[model samples]
Target chain A: MTTLTENPNVAATADTHHGPAKGLKRWLYTTNHKDIGSLYLWFAFIMFLIGGAMAMVIRAELFQPGLQIVDPHFFNQMTTVHGLIMVFGAVMPAFTGLANWMIPMMIGAPDMALPRMNNFSFWILPFAFLILIMTLFMEGGGPAFGWTFYAPLSTTYSSDTTALFVFSVHIMGISSIMGAINVIVTIWNMRAPGMTWMKMPLFVWTWFITAFLLIAVMPVLAGAVTMVLTDKFFGTSFFDAAGGGDPVMFQHIFWFFGHPEVYIMILPAFGVISAIVPTFARKPLFGYASMVYATASIALLSFVVWAHHMFTTGMPLFGELFFMYCTMLISVPTGVKVFNWVATLWRGSISFEVPMLFALAFIVLFTIGGFSGLMLAITPVDFQYHDTYFVVAHFHYVLVTGAVFSIIAAAYYWLPKWTGVMYDVTLAKAHFWCSLISVNLLFFPMHFVGLAGMPRRIPDYSLQFADFNQWISIGGFAFGLSQLIFLALLIKACRKQGKPVDAKVWDGAEGLEWEVASPAPYHTFSTPPKIK
Target chain B: MTRANLVLLRKLVLVVFGMFLFGFALVPLYDTFCEITGINGRIIVKAEDSDADKVVSDRRVKIQFLVKTDAKNEFDFKSNQKFIEVKIGELSEVSFEVKNKTSSLQLAQAVPSVSPGTASLYLNKTECFCFSQQILQANETVVYPMRFFIDEDLPEDISLLTLSYTLYQAQSVQASYSKSELDKGAS
Candidate 1:
């Protein structure tokens, strides 16, 4: 339908015939999706380490209760920035990076539809985060209002850093929107001649839906942060209850963007797991159509369930029930997904490659997170679990084991394709096992402490929680160190230290990405391959 | 990638812009939603131009006043009368005494909420100090007046309604009231 289709061979020859430009300039000025993809992945890894460092501070402070290394205010900043960095900087970008590296290849298309815009999106993230990080050194030490940044705490009581925090988040939102738009346009217009809708890879499918979700919600987040800005600096009382605006209203608006924003993080992981599970199991994904429908349903349900986050905000009885039931409804489709994954593995020839093993862990751990989420969705019980360590444990399971684990799986699954060599299996497996065990050690007891009435986001706790706190801290440190192993594996593979491999790196691998050469070339599918 | 797909790209851009506007739209939308559902406990009733259709029922509901202030607020605020009994749908009046013990011009904003939660929808205030900030000159003691009527539709199971006002001291709260009229016609 475009000039790219006019003379496919010419387009292929022109872009692919030349090798990548040299040095740092390739990364600085490049529009190639693969280059941009690598940039996003590496940047996210660094941010992960930075955010993880903050978590270490939090765990260390909580290790034995009463004020130790850092003061309470600084501890608040640690929690706030840690959450902001991990959600926005690490997980979201890593998934987008995956989308960039893999989507065009999987769909047999030539590059993302708007490659230049893709570069711009990936580039802006570091600067946006810099603006946010700049806040810590500012007068009041960053936003201590928690990542939720609820009203009054973010407004009347916040330090001068709020303006900078708002601006940083705005730039990040812009990057996400541009990135999302490019993904949507590429998937919509650039698929190969015969790669019809259903035949597309599950990763491509999940990303397409996620792109729409990003477009829909990122602006809403922009709106939320802007209100926070105006309330603090511009003398607008959009959240000040004394000024005809209710603080509780901010929670409603924040979660409206917030709920879907969460799905945006996890849905891509769903697609990643969908791809990895079947490949290792040597079976077509069971309930394929149901999986698609379930993803869509989960996205739809995300919009309605935001208020469950605000159950304790004194919302009307009806609203609490409505949101609670809506949240519970999400588990239905989520349950469908888990059953489908297990069904795909039923008595099939399954091998525990690193990717498959991570995917399996994701299924088990994310389900635990989901079940806890279900428990929280009950309006009455949520009153108990609302801000406790239980809530912390619940999300870490989903985000770490669920989203982060899936990302690690995707990275391992495609590493050979990207690097043209097989990474050291023993080292990778060693990294995996260490991470799996330590992560559980780190997060599992959070449920007990949380359930035992230990509130989250606090610097120190009473003597009763001191024992659980120590074990949880140990887990936190171990999990943080284990990520270093994955980094070494990545660095070694990138340096081409592994054994060389041909196309179709894994024997059970399917789809168009596997059909391409190992190392994937500087350009992929410049001439769209006929599907069928 | 293609001409037709460029059209899709354009539409997606529109969706992004539209959702941005929708974000702003949620403020008014949430206000409307809460107003309709009587959730969020936001008090937004204007002086009714006319409630001549009101019916005064025989059912008696005791209205109690609860006042609270943040740590910084040292001003003395309390309803002069501890509690008052009013028939359902009948207009009733009560007075609150606010003593600005602090030695400077202060803008005090009072936020109101009703207990039993559902009572917020039925408790209509026609004239109240919470309608706007009460500006008090140094040590100016103002006894503010409030008038209200409970809707006849007040459910039978509720007999006691607690109307609470939370006082906040602010240097400025998004308005500029004239100093000359600060104490006009108040006791």
Candidate 2:
């Protein structure tokens, strides 16, 4: 039973009591994974607030319909920036942040294999967001195309500021790719001696796959946006038909990157759920091997299903059918993951801690989101659903309730470990219940309205859709405000004046993370633990 | 460095370079796909009934009607003039001039529906295209730009096709105004 300590050269001589780096130098030149991880988390939180405010503006406009608060154009800008910020700035970074904080501790690693690059990865984000928000003040205003930035709309008719949007996205993609590379390398190289591939935590495995997906597709996004920039400013007609470019082709290229991007948002959430469920249930994870395979299957399926988003854009029938089948197949693996979580909870001593509560909610609500996704995968069904409030409902269910919820769950589950202080159970559970109910109220009716043919991205809608839109707005505002409770809880927890936690925070916890003391130090695993 | 460490470094360089190559080749590969999917617009030659009946002179007279929109609501609507056929390899700017054909002053956006319902006409302003929706006085003629040239890739079988605009009048605040609403417009 050899451990990192067995290698005295690596362990006894290694700095065990390494505190976080000091001053501006600590932030700029430090390679500490936890510091970099915190940087990512704080940056993501700020972007979430900014992006959330944009959503409030969007909801305010849609509250009563008829283009009440903002012009359809500015409303569009809100929609575009809101989407870009949330997907890249909020969800992706949150997951990356979690990966940074947890992976080394979970897998018994000393540190991320490349830590300087990790710092570079995080700092790039604020600048990217700043450039993007600045575009709102530009000559024609920021990008008004939906986050998808579908062609002709993005290319031919776009604003002068779209060039700025393109450049900012390029930098964001670079950051994501670098961050992902660091994850993949650390996972591959730094695992403790006895921590075999199967022994790795689900969080690490899912991120390992997610990182690969990010690397493969984010570059494609950068390339797609680059073409748009050239098309707009350089007189190239990559999307201009007069110059022999087809606009539909731009869609093909963009979605090739985009569909995988969707999976990138959710896969790590799957990993987080997998980790949280077993720990709370006081049982071993059901079908652990299957969970791994299912994650891999989802990532593979992601690439082929990009065309599902473009079905109504008039793709060839064969392409449509191929993408449809590929997309539906994903539901099988996703369903397996869900079943495993529920099955783990079955016949076990399960108590609803804040983390467990959010986890359980994720299982139910994400499945609901998954079912809608299955419905959207059917080409004929999607033809009816595309660009409608239904698509909006489907994603918000998965994202706000699905990915964002998992992040909250993971936060609560690990907060004790990260801060050595237990959160207020009453307040944390209150946040969970309010979020779950309000989120459903917000997004569930969108399915009905979307099915009834309410198009999305329109500042105003026809009278028939008015009632549901109003209800959705109320739910949205409530959900947005409820997040403030989470912010307050986090602040209170970080102050370290709450319930004291033992080394293993959860009764059924496994993995190197719980093996370490709560409130993980600046440098953990200076000597990696033996897994076996 | 240890042998294992050296192997790891080599693998890292290869993987990184491989990824770089994949990214560098992406645009060209996408361009190839685009070229394959792109439909070379047809050259449509249709004589008026006079040419069709052989009643017109052999000396060919080419008449081009420029299609243009008023630059108001220009981007609000998606337009396609791609199906409109012109002579192959012809060096003429086929313009669709959209006159505020309405009697009352109207701010109208014109889209040159070309490029197979996928291409939008990008309008650059002579000055600043400051207002997306132009303010046209009654009986004012502000020509919108939907200028494009017939590509050299036109096929021989196709002939004359028409580029027509069925312009819809936008709802203007002058005709129907509100303070809260007017303040929110994207100028």
Candidate 3:
């Protein structure tokens, strides 16, 4: 108060200095949402690469039916750790990183509602993943119980380093919860005047719902892992039948969290697609209200459908019917979303930018994944698909093609805004086509082999599955290599090698984010912009 | 960041804590749900009926016995008769011989589960060796007896049921152990 009265000009000058700081401290100690967002994106990408490499090892081992590159145990570790890293370390974090960068900009807030909390959440992820990866080198190797880590397998037969895995997952849960709280608070309070609930961008709306899902389920995951920890180390039998508990309860509790978790990874992708599809098509989205409701409905139905994952786990017939029907019901809202995107593209001036290409692929492939999920929801049919490569193929289409591809799309969509330079168009196109073909090749064959009775998480397969496995491995390698083009494109954009882009880099792009200068000023909308 | 926002923040934090407790609550909640729905195939004891002497002699049902032992703990477990045909409402007895292959004293328990899950409600155990821990001397073999009956009310469509006992070895079965409220791995 005294400074404003005695030296008003000095206070004014300090407030006007909005450029970023000079060195590594700018990232390490800064609370700037953009810087922290960059940190998270980089961390997620690195984790993605590590997880993808593990997938490569898995595919290589499966290439010829007999273990060639790694032992069976190591291959189990690869599959388990690969799942853990991708779900927690790659897809979830990438969505969060995008929220940090874009949410405040969309809502016209100067920064995240709690900037320090943002930094804390991002920093813990690397450490948590480090602890998890460290277990691979420890005795007994990493978790071989698969990512689901069901009882008996997780409890009786798990590696000695199970405690480390539990603690690492616990850390991730905490980080996610804290990150979610920040998101909810930011969107709830920081919208610019006149930017009412319905007026907010689809990205912001999806994130708001996703934040709730995070808060609701991440704790359940923590509880599940805690039970696993106690059952193994503390002599408790939360999932042990001999001790008056049942292992089937583990599946119930886990899928409660796990099912919503599946949506948490994809809901934001819905938001990204909703935003991009309209921008490229040059159409004000076909069914914005329905899209929001659809996202909400999908989230709500997620709780009831968790048991669909456990259909073959031996649930009662009624339970099976209920879950199967509920799982299929999600398709209703999901179909609404798919329809909205297609409708937006109908009779519109569509241009296929790199982001649009990924978005279009996301819609088609995610639908395929959704359809397969529906197929598995039928209890009797799931018995056939359970533990098979078909299950593997289903999730990858949604995750790699759905959630992951959307993240890549968002990055390309906004990279010009964040970097002030365009990414190399030709290289990006090549990256897109190669990824499109290879990703399909990688996941598509798994469906065939899965249906043909090839169980997943095995290092060796029968002679019959040999050909499809070869094609799958080749596809996996190609997909893995294709990502390098992305890495190169990103490096070039960051170096400002490409031509500069003005604010509103895309002709039809619309948002507060584009109203500011390219490479958005370090402190934007300092005085919140009015929506009108 | 603002006063109203802080309130929102506080409420969200409470939701986080509440959800954590809710996760733990699901344990008991699950048990209660399973008990009510009979979804998990937990065998509930039935009242001794005076009419139980009327074993439906003409109608035949097959009882297949299965024992599951952890491969880690070297042990031999076998049902004396792999299967037996008994009339509905008939009392049947089976013996399982288990030997502790390990050289030290070890504790073992068999958790029984009925398959075709709905059959769990139709079957009642007169005496079964579960819940109570079985402590055997080093390399000792023990034969445990189980007595059970298929209730006359068992569905006509089902003629066979598998009674599986999953054998587990623990240092101890804590006295604090209680039946999980509702669910069993029976299915």
Which one is best on TM-score?
Answer: 1
Q: For model 1 chain A, where is the 10-residue window of minimal lDDT?
A: A1-10
RMSD, every candidate, angstroms = 4.6, 11.0, 5.0
Question: Residue A148 in candidate 3 has what lDDT?
Answer: 94
Q: Is the docking of candidate 2 incorrect, acceptable, medium or high quality?
A: incorrect
Kindly list the per-residue Cα lDDT of model 1 for residues A138-198, writing each as its tens digit. Answer: 8889989999899989998999898989999999999999999998888888889999889
Candidate 1 interface RMSD (Å): 3.3
- Per-residue CA lDDT of candidate 3, range A1-532, in tens? 1111111111122345655555565666779888777777877888999999999888888889676789888988999999999999999999999999899999999999998888889888888999999999999998999999999788978987999999999999999998999999999888889889998899999999999999999999999999999989888988887677889899989989999999999999999999999999999999889989999999899888888887777776777888888888999999999999999999999999999999999999999999998888888989999989999999999999999999999999999888888889999999999999999999999999999999988899899999999999999999999999998888777767888788899998888999987777777788999787
- Fnat, model 2, is 0.07
lDDT of 1 at B146: 91
- Superposition error at A73 for model 1 (Å): 0.7
Tens-place lDDT per residue, model 2, B1-187, is 2365346546654665565556547555755453354322211111112112222222222222334333444322223234443333332333233344445666552212323321111111122111233556755554444333333333333234343343434443233222322233332
Overall lDDT per candidate, in order of appearance:
0.86, 0.73, 0.86
Give the lowest summed-lDDT range of ten residues in model 3 chain A.
Answer: A1-10
DockQ for every model, please. 0.52, 0.06, 0.62
